[model samples]
Target: MILITGAAGNLGSAIINSLLKKVPANQLAAFVRSEQKAEQLKKLGLNIRIGDYNDIASLDNAMKGIEKVLLISGLSMERLKEHTNVVDAAKRAGVKQIVYTGVTMKDAAVSPLKVLMESHFQTENYIKASGIPYTFLRNTLYAEVIPFYIGDQALNTGIHYPAGAGRVPYVYRPDLADATAVVLTNKGHENKTYQLTGDQLYSFTDVAGMLSEVSGKHIAYTDVDPVAFEKHMKEIGVPEIGIMISTGFAAAIKQGDFEVVTADLEKLLGRKPTPVKQYLKAHYVG
Candidate 1:
């Protein structure tokens, strides 16, 4: 059986749906925290396993007999103890291949997400030590996440974030999901690290231009200092931790760390990844 944790979440659901097209639903097991979520997934014709990372025994039972497992990263910012439970349970369950969805902050020396990198590296270490073959899909920023920051507000006020007009190497989640499904089903992808991202580089100014063209609304891009950007986020009541993460990532983008594209994702999926503007038109315009 192939187990997918966080099966109720957006990324997990996308991955599960993609995998279902290739593998039988019964051959796929979904591990979620809540009974409501389990019921929902069951209605979709999935094998349900009730488990939570907080409860190691539940995780252990849920993972038993699973050949390949996808450990979708959790959302709990300050509380990462749950990730530990998953690593231990997967270890004991003797899972054959483990695929992890991780952030693209791989350069430990110059990474903006210094604090967040530790958890991903720790998980990577655990997978390496587990005696199970592993694949790390080191994902870039989501394309959809951009609209949440620059969308309707730009439509109304004509101005979006002023993070020095940096370029973002946004990755489409559905594309990432497709690439991941290939690894889960196909062989010879073990112990590989894939930095998945979009086919093109897009700056914030380019984003504004795309939105304006699509929506027929005039939008302007402003360059704001990092300090001022953080202050703006705070004045708008953005959580401190989230602000730090956003600011650090924005700084990194401005420095051109995310502009490079790799063929690893396309080679795995047998197709090209989605472009940023097209994704925005599909997601935001309609």
Candidate 2:
């Protein structure tokens, strides 16, 4: 059976939905952390297993008889510890191959998630050493989240950020999910790394221009002072530590930290990824 951990999440749900089209329901298994989530997956016709990242024993039990596994990265502070447990359990369960969703962060990138990038790479190394056939899907920033970064505040308050000249090759989440489904179902992708991203790049200025065209309003991208931004974040209850790390990332973006381009995603999905403007027009204008 092909098992998907963190099965109730967005990425997991997308992968599962796509898999249902290609594989039978009995061949699919979902690992969740609660009865509510289990019942939800069961409603979709999946074999359900309950487990948590904190509970290694449950993970071990969940992995039994599962041939292939999708190890979705966790968002917890103890992520490394939790992911390590899955790797160990998968190995002992005689799983054939494992796939992981990881991030693509340059060592020099200045973002709040830089520490997360370090941990991700460390986990990649550890998984490699474990000797199970593996695929590390180093995903780029999601186009879905670009709006949150831009928000409705951009329409009324203007787009204010420290990302000066940084460009991001943002791909839609469903596209990434489709590429992942391809890797999961097809053979010959084992023991490889794919930097999945879009065919084009867009800076924040490009985003503002698109917003202006679609919304029929003047939406400006402003290069704001980092100190002012930090002060505002503090006033709004953003933690000092969060502000410190985020400031670094925002500054790094100005240095072109997220400026990356790749075609690995298109080759896998057999189609062009969704354009950023399509999402912007639908969500921002309507």
Candidate 3:
């Protein structure tokens, strides 16, 4: 049986939906924060287990009779500890394999993405040290989340960002989820790390063009100074952590941290992934 943690999350839900087409419902389980959070998955006749990565006992219970686990990365200072708890529980539960959703920062050893996502590196180390058969899905930035970073403020004030003309191969969350399901169901993935990225590379200017074309508005991109961007984030009442991530991520992009192209994603879906223009229209426009 395969179990997915953080089951209510977007990526987790997509993975579950994709797996349902191949794996039987009886063999699928969802580990969520609570029964209330899992009602929809339960309605689909999936086995639901209430567990938190912070709680080892809960994770142990959730992992019962589960052979493979998809440990979706967490989002906080406690991420590393949380992942370690899940790995330890899975080991005790006799899980045969673990599929980890990790990050892909180009030249991680010397990038701002590395500094911001230190937990991912630690978690990867812990999982490897645990001696469990593992598949690491080194996913790039999610294009679906571009809304959060780009913001509607960009529409009114034009696109103001610290990133220069560097490009990012942003992968769709659903596509990564679909790929994760395939890895979980198939064999020969143990100890493998797949660098998954979109087929196309787009810069912030490219994104501005996409928004302009789709919304029929004259949107523009301005390359702001990093200090000015940080000040702007503060002026907009962004929290300290949010401000750091925003500025650092933009800096990483400017330094060509995410400008990677790979055929692995196409191999995962057996088709060309959707284009940014199409995604922009479908998401931002009518």
Candidate 4:
């Protein structure tokens, strides 16, 4: 059976949903931290394995009888160690392959998010050193987060941020999950890396235009200064860390960190991935 770590998370849940279409529920296992979180998976008839990435024994039990594992990266200060714990447990449990979800960056050394991406780099290296066959899905920014980036009052106040003219090939989350499922259930993907990105790149300016067209309201993008953006976020009650992360990503976009577009997602899904404009129309127009 294939085990998916962080199965209660959005991406993990989506992957489980996609995998159910390709394989029986009995063929998949959902790994969560608690019995309460496994309720939905239980209703789906999936084997719910309660485990924590930090707990090697729990992870070992979760990986029992599992042939392959999808190691969703964790979000924490101890993320690197947590990922290693999962890898170690998987190795001991004799998992044949490991699929990791990592971030997509053109160059890791110069990427503005290098510090944040370091854990992923270390996890990838750890997986490689573990001698387990692996597939790395280097996923780009999710299009689903555009709403958060633009904010609820974007249509009224126009698209105000510090992204400048940089473009991002934001792949839809479900598409990534679908491609991941394809890799999990298919062969010839072992020891390979796939950049899961949208087929087209879109700047905030382009997004503004799309929003205007979809909402029938004039919208514009303002490339504000980083300092001013931070101040505005602070005035709006955004936490210090939130401001830092937002500015960092804006800087990364301005530096063209996420401008890389690839057909890997399309090839895996056997069709073109969803476009940013289309996603805007569906979510904003309604």
Candidate 5:
């Protein structure tokens, strides 16, 4: 069976939905951290298994007889530790192939989000060392991150963020999910790392323009100091930790860190991924 952790999450649910079209329901496993969430997945006629990265015993049970596994990165700054737990559990469960979602530009030794990239690299190292065949989906910034980052403010007072004028190869999570499910179900992806991204690159200013055009509002991108940005985020009740992480990503973009879109994504999915403009319209407008 193909096991998917974080099954209740957006990307996980999308992956499951995409795989269902190509694979049988009995061949799918929804690995969740909570039994309550498992119940939600159960309604979809899936084999729900309770598992947590922290609980090795639960992970072992979740992976029983499962040949392929999708190891969605756990949320939080402590992603490295969380992934280590997953790697250990997968190894013990004797899973054959593991597909992990990592970040794009992770090979760069130094980046603004070193903490985040290092976490993926560390887990990638563990997966390789375990002697288990693995596929690393080195994904770019999620296009949907914009809505979460600025939607409330845009709805409130038309305020946005510290995105500056930098461009990002903002990928849609659903597209990434499609490619991820394909790799997990198909062969020849073993030991390969795919840098998944959208069809083109775009900037925060570009996003604001699209939103303005779509919503027929005068939304604008404002530039601010990093310190001021964090302060504003905290004042707006964004957690201190979350402020740091978000600001760090913005800083990375300002340095032209995540602007490259590779051919690996199209090669893997055997189709062109959606463009950022189309994604913005589909998700934000309609």
Candidate 6:
């Protein structure tokens, strides 16, 4: 059976949904911390394995009889430790293969988002050292995050940010999930890494134009100074940490850190990845 950690989460659930189309529910096992959180998966006839990344015993118990594992990265201050716990548990369980979700920053040393991505780099190294056959899905920023970057009042106040003229190949999360499922069910992907990104590059200016066309509103993009952006976020009651995180990502974008694009996603799906304009139209149009 294939065990999927964080099975109830957005990306994990999407991957499960994609997996369901190709395999039976009996072939799938969902690892969740609480039974209550897994009610939907349970109703779907999946084997429910109770576990937490913080609890190695629970993880080990969950991995019992599991052949392959999808180690969905955790979001926490203790992310690296928790990920190591999962890796260690998988090691003890003798899992045949491990698939990990990672970010698509080609050069972590020069990327402004290095601090945020350090755990992923460390986890990748740890996984390699564990002697387990693995596949690393290095995913780019999701197109679903555009709404968050633009904010609720973007239609009126325009896309105000400090991303500058740099572009990103913002991929759709569902497409990434689909590719992950393909890797999980198929072979010849062992010890490989794939950069999951959109087929096209786009900047905030391009996003505003698409939104304007889709929503019939004159949306615009303003490349504000980083200091001014932080001040605005602070005045709007954004937490200090949130402001810092946003600024860091903006700096990375401004430096063209997310500009990489590849045909890996298209090759996996056997079709072109969804365009940013299509996504914008779906979410912005009535």
lDDT, each prediction: 0.79, 0.84, 0.87, 0.91, 0.81, 0.91
Q: Taking the tens digit of each residue's C-alpha lDDT, what string does model 1 give over 1-286?
A: 9999999999999998899889988899999988898887898788888978888789988987899889998877633477768877887888888899887643645766566666776777777876778999888789978866664566666654655655767888889889889999899889989988776778888887887887788767776776887788899898987787777767777766566677777888788887777877776677
Clashes of 4: 0
Alpha-carbon shift of residue 258 in model 3 (angstroms): 1.1
Relative to the true structure, candidate 5 has a C-alpha RMSD (angstroms) of: 2.1
Q: By summed lDDT, which 10 consecutive residues of candidate 2 come out lowest?
A: 104-113
- Candidate 2 residue runs with Cα over 4 Å from true position: 108-112, 239-248
How much is 143 displaced in model 6, in angstroms? 0.2
Clashing pairs in 2: 110-249, 111-249
lDDT of 3 by residue, 1-286 (tens): 9999888999999899999998888899999998799999999889999979888789989989999999999887778888999999999988999999988776777898676576777888898999999999989899886777788656666888889998889888888888898899999999998889998899989999989888778899989888988888899799999988887788889999888888887897898876867777878775
User: Alpha-carbon error at 59 in model 3, in Å?
Assistant: 1.2
Model 3: residue 212 alpha-carbon error in angstroms: 2.2
* Deviation (Å) of 200 in candidate 2: 1.3
Which residue runs does candidate 6 get wrong by more than 4 Å? none
Q: What is the alpha-carbon lDDT for the whole of candidate 2? A: 0.84
Kindly report which residue stretches of model 3 are placed more than 4 angstroms away from their true locations once superposed.
none
Residue-level lDDT of model 5, residues 212-274, one tens digit each, is 877778777776678887877889798877877788887888777888789887887788877
Residue 146 CA displacement from its true place in model 6, Å? 0.8
Error of 5 at 128 (Å): 0.7
The model with the greater TM-score, 4 or 5, is: 4
Q: How many backbone clashes are present in model 1?
A: 0
Candidate 2 lDDT by residue in tens digits, 1-286: 9999989998899889888888888888999999998887898889999989779899889988898999999988789898899999999998999999988656633555566566778788889999999999988888777665665667776788877768888888888888998999999999999999888888889989988888889989987888898888889897776776567666766766666677899999998989888888877777
- Structure candidate 6, residue pairs in collision: none
- What is model 6's C-alpha RMSD? 1.1
Better of 3 and 5 by TM-score: 3
